[model samples]
Target chain A: MPTVRINDENVTFNEGATVVDAVAQTTGRELTAEGKPADGGRLGVAVALAEEVVPRSRWAGVELSEGDQLEIVTAVQGG
Target chain B: MADMSLPPLQIGGYSLESRLIMGTGGITDLAALEAALVQSGTTLTTVAMRRYSPETKTSVFSMLERLGIDVLPNTAGCYTVRDTLLTAELAREALETDLIKVEVIADEHTLLPDVIETLEATEQLAERGFTPLVYTTDDPAAARRLESAGAAAVMPLGSPIGTGLGILNPHNIELICSRASVPVVLDAGIGTASEAAAAIELGCDAVLVASAVTRAQDPTAMAEGMRLAVEAGFHSARAGRIPKRQHALASSPMEGRIDLT
Candidate 1:
């Protein structure tokens, strides 16, 4: 089992799981059983793992490794 | 009723009721973007196209259409004339609009527009019957050249994109606004409502901003602030400012009637 850190929270995952799956599991998001975020998850926010922006759809293909930093940035509208 | 006598801003014969322009890149979600757009009271919205994805179909475009916003597709990542032209053509076909936000960057690090390439692409796009809104630097000479080349509007970056440093050079922006015949929009590098207001106060025709509102702690509130800032800036500009003098004013009655002395 390989472990990854998301926003400083450590979570262990199966070897081949993508970063998205890891987040879905850790955050108890609906990606595991239910396909989507119920109403098209938060916008303007992106998940950056290893300094590269990972599209929402590509979360499945992105494999995780030990000590990878996953950052989730959500949009907050202000002037 | 509040004074509603503000004249509509004309760009290529299109009268935009609102002076604020929103960028589609930084919204938390399409839904949020929609909410902010409504709150901002802006009719024009900008979207960028580079690496086309089939999956993006029906979601992004459809949502924008549902909001009834006029889309201004941009050549955000193009660095050359060929790519810019192709992207503009594709955007026209896909977005069904002849309006293009032309941004030709020479360096990815700073995201500064390549002046020569930008002019070349602008000339071509204008000749092709597309309304070109060129994003450029705050050089008066460059802005004048773009105007002569027939740019519909000239957008000068307040600073680098997404840094939110606000207006770095107010004098240069003022220079551009004063010299250009076309609409002058202060684009990029705006971090807050104050920055937007400052640009408008400097007599810019409009302000195009994204990350400031979309990346804020509360996007909807920030959008409203931006709206107010533009209005305030416009009003301030119209009201005219008093001249600043280096010497102190003689208000203390040096020789005048001072009964309490």
Candidate 2:
């Protein structure tokens, strides 16, 4: 099991789990719609892996590794 | 004079006809927000970036897109340069726009922009090809620093965020506007239509308001007021206001006095 950090929370994933899986395990939220994985974060969510921002299109291609840091961001209300 | 066109408010590469920019925070009602956004005629509005929450049903971005208004993501709650930069990067990626409002706040109570962190974040964001609209104090020197660091615009606070104090330091805001080569948007602390108008009359390129309309009893009416005030302010700035005088000068000519005749 490879240990990874999603936005600073340490978690272990099965071998070869991608970035989207790590996000779901850590945040208990999906980047995609419940039934729709094709449309990822149409609601303006962003992710950065190890401090380097990765767009939604590349989420599935980027696999998680040991000690990988993932930062998740979404749009919320503010002044 | 009535039909005179107001000068466009230009920031970065985008030129907006409306001198009013809105913030989406503090407005809980989506329908009301839609009405306010429409009535305000704001081309660029602010949205804050946070972690995705499945519980939250309303999406401000969807509303913005439906209305055809441009979204300007903000680093509103960030306190450190690193956090601000990260949030800004995420915002740029999420929004798919280079435009960002850099707000490195001091504390929870005041919510004022931290000068050092703001400048640092602005520089890093600018280097990354982002157009940062920096929020800073009314200090003219601070505004100059951000502009020198490649900020698209210098947004000086009229007072604290959401305080509605309305231009606490007119001279300071004026000084900032005078020295600023980029657009000087009077951000935050606007109480009503007059404050928005007054900010523009003080030479601000535009005025950013959120609570004044969002929290108002009738948000729709307040939004309309802000829109009209912005237009009025633009025209008043161009119409050439009379110089201030210690004593009142009679509108009627002295020669028109019947006793003198």
lDDT, candidate 1, A1-79, per-residue tens: 7787775777788888786676466445556322245556422224666645565667777788888887643211222
- How high is the TM-score of chain A in each model? 0.70, 0.74
Q: Give fnat of each prediction, in order.
A: 0.00, 0.63
Off by over 4 Å in 1: A1-79, B50-54, B247-261
Poorest 10 consecutive residues by lDDT, candidate 1 chain B: B49-58
Off by over 4 Å in 2: A1-14, A20-43, A66-69, B253-261
TM-score of each: 0.72, 0.88
Candidate 2 backbone collisions, by pair: none
- Best of the candidates, DockQ: 2
* lDDT of each residue in B1-261, candidate 2, tens digit only: 355766777889878777889988787788888898899998889888876555543278777877888888999889999989888888987788999999999999989889998998899999989998999998898999999998999999998998988999999998888888899999989999999989998999899999999999998899999999988888888789989999998888777556744
Alpha carbon lDDT at B130, candidate 2: 91
Scored by TM-score, the top model is: 2
RMSD over all Cα atoms, model 1: 10.9
